[model samples]
Target: KEGRKLEQTARLIQKTAEAKNMPATKRAALNMQKLGRRMAQGRMDKKQAMVRMAQLTKQMQAQQRQLAQQAGQAALGGGKSLSQAGQQLAAALQSQAAGGQNAQGASKMQGAHSAGSKSTGEKSGANGGNKPAGQNAGHGFNVPGRNKPGDKPPQNALHGAAQPTPEMKQIAQALQQNNAQTLSEQLRQLARKAETGQMTPQQQQQAAQDLQKLADALQGTGMPETQQHAQAAAQAMAHGDKQTAAAEMRKAADAAEREAQQQQDAQGMQDAQNSLQDSQGEMAGAQDPGDIPDGPSGQGQGQKPGGKGQGQTGPPEYGGEGNGGRGGGRGKPNTTYHKGQKPSHKIRQKPGYGADAPHWLDPHFDPAKNPRYAKLYFGKPRTAGPSQAGPTRKTRPGEDTGPVRSTVPYYNSVVSARKTAENAMDREDIPPAYKKNVADYFNSLQPQSPPPPASSGAGGTKP
Candidate 1:
């Protein structure tokens, strides 16, 4: 009986130790391994591990309590085996938790409890040097390049470069946006070269430059983000200076500026963007119905860049008839003209110019097949004044008819191009001077038309 009692006591003590031991479940072991590795990497120290372990222990205690309650209920009902096991497990955990064991302690125990076996933490913290410059003793607190030392994070962004601030993100965004458009073409070119199995050094250099510019811009914006980036760059350069030495230097300098507190990230002295946006709104609200737009800015609309006139091509009905005035027409000033008349295919050739009159007329104007002006003249062939009122042909021969008649279709074509171009350019908030040039170019293309047809034998003979 005495021997049995001693055995029982030993068993009880062993069980208690087991409970306190906090079984290294696969998850627990993994966590321990991770902590050990981090410590060895010089990324963390004993204190950091302790903090983490403490956090984990709290979670385990909560789970243990719930299990105990379930087991207690079972035991009360006479279903004792499973309940017994739960009770034992609960008691074990309670003892450890009561002893104030923390996650950090548990993690350290994993290292101390095992030996002769290699471990991540031991391997990493191998130098046995405490507090290496760049590495945190525990919990990944190291700045970049401790053996090399990274710059401290921007003070404004965090207490001491610990967390990213909103300003930092904005700076990053600006950095990316500034370079995005310009390098789009270059990116495409590189992609093409890769597909074709070759890349040029120049292309590679340009690509690196583009990326450097963006990274620097973000860092220099006085954002906490700069610290993270700065660290990364330092690490990259630590290896016998870096591969992209020149490029990295540029990026670092750029970031240095961003990290400066005096450089306001937003609302800088040179910011002209807001004024530009207001200008755009004014332009949107101020679009004219009569102008036919043209330019790289005007797509689908048949106008030229700089608001220069392009002769109408194809059928006139493809586009609505030329705007007669500001409110009614698409490309020109809306006026009393075409008010009563329904929109039609009439091409207003040159206006107010008699048939066959001057050399200054549009050189591209074709009488037989110019679709834009054909309708205006065709609609009212006899509209020209009578011969007594005026000669059909102003010149005897070889002289031009000033310009072609103002045909509804052709006039409307001009209006379409002008309007579309104007809308696009205006939206972009281009300078007023540039916009004016666009407007003036269109106005110059208005075709001169003939007077009412002559009544008797005029110089012109009609088929």
Candidate 2:
């Protein structure tokens, strides 16, 4: 069993070594494609495209250089697959980068020519030549091999600006298939249609196909209920029942989330299991080897593998807490027990057993009176941190404390409270008298000005 385990470990190590460059290489290729898509869609302008293309090309070159080291390592591990894939992807990226630069330059030149043409036409019109370009250019204006405003550009137009390389497309396709993001997006679109109460026959048919694919992808993940819901949704879509389809798709989405969480937990459990198995194998191998036969040299067959010393004759020292051996002292044996009962050890006492805790542990205990605890048990007070410090109020021993001024402005605090009380008062279950009192209290709390005095006598001469 140990030999078999060692063989498996060796194979896993080799596999890991061969795939060391896979993730970064794949990422570089996919980023190149995403940048191309952005440029083609006009989301990225010319200067930005040039800078990004240059950076991506540089990254690909660096990744290629790293591939050399990876290749050497993989060769020592007996494989060159990673190096080969990296080389191919790097070459593709370089070629694609060159093509993108050329296309961008061409587009820039075309834009310059168009600007020149417009300027020349404007000058000619000013000088009494033919009407300037774009005159009467609106609805119903057509020019051969050209698209008007608000018209969808031809597919060739996108290709002319920036085209994705074959390697990038393959990487993107593989990513999309592996991830559930596309599945979730499709379900969202179907849900939108259902919400709008508008699902055409063609759309319904397409949704059915998407749901079927989702069902197939979810197979054997211990989520048969999700699969069933997905299939039922697909069937309902085919029958043109948007409501039923939407409900089923919702169930499928919830199940998929749960399944994802379960998969994550299962992966963690698998890692722990592998660790436990490794430890168990190590312990088993370290066991007594005295019974095995000796070789012709008359040497004892009790030594550990890898030319180590003789097998451990005593208990192995596992550096864990509690019980037995030199690394950990043997715990006290079980002694206290009722009559006619088997003695057993207890790591903890019953619930009420520790009610009379030590004096130092009491919640109300003051460390200030105990010099030992005051210096050792208590930590020094921390200085004020980022929060603002407020003024500390001091008063004589018999002075009465007045209402403290609020930190917040009265208007800022009272408005929300009054609004809440008003809303609560609107409830019919409360007595009208209580509501009147609450309203009067809030009204009186409002800020008021002192009444004018002695104005009437000064304004009038003698009445």
Top candidate (TM-score): 2
Error of 1 at 264 (Å): 17
At residue 153, give the lDDT of candidate 2: 34
lDDT of 1 by residue, 1-463 (tens): 2222222333443343344342322233334345445544657533564565455455444543443343232212222232232233234334433443354355455535443344644554455334544334333233222232344522221112222222222333433443322222332333344335352332233333333333433332223333344444434433323344334434444543432211221211112222223323443465333232212111111222223232222121122222111111133311112124333222222222111111232433333445443332222122222121111222222334454443244443666777786785667433332355456556655534534576667676642
**Model 2, range 1-463, lDDT digits (tens) per residue?**
3333433443443343335433443354355446545655667544575566567656655554454343233212323232233344345444555775676566556546654676565654456333233332221122222333455433233222234323233422432343334334445556667657675444466556556555554444334555678889878877888888888877766654454333333333233234334534463455433122211110111111222111111101111111111112112112223244342212221111111112323333333344433312222222323322121222232344454333444444567878887876676322343355457556755643333354466575421
State residue 370's C-alpha deviation in candidate 1, in Å.
8.4
Predicted structure 1: lDDT: 0.34
Question: TM-score of predicted model 1?
Answer: 0.17
Candidate 1 local Cα displacement, residue 95, angstroms: 33
Worst 10 residues of 1 by lDDT: 293-302
| CA-lDDT, candidates in order | 0.34, 0.42
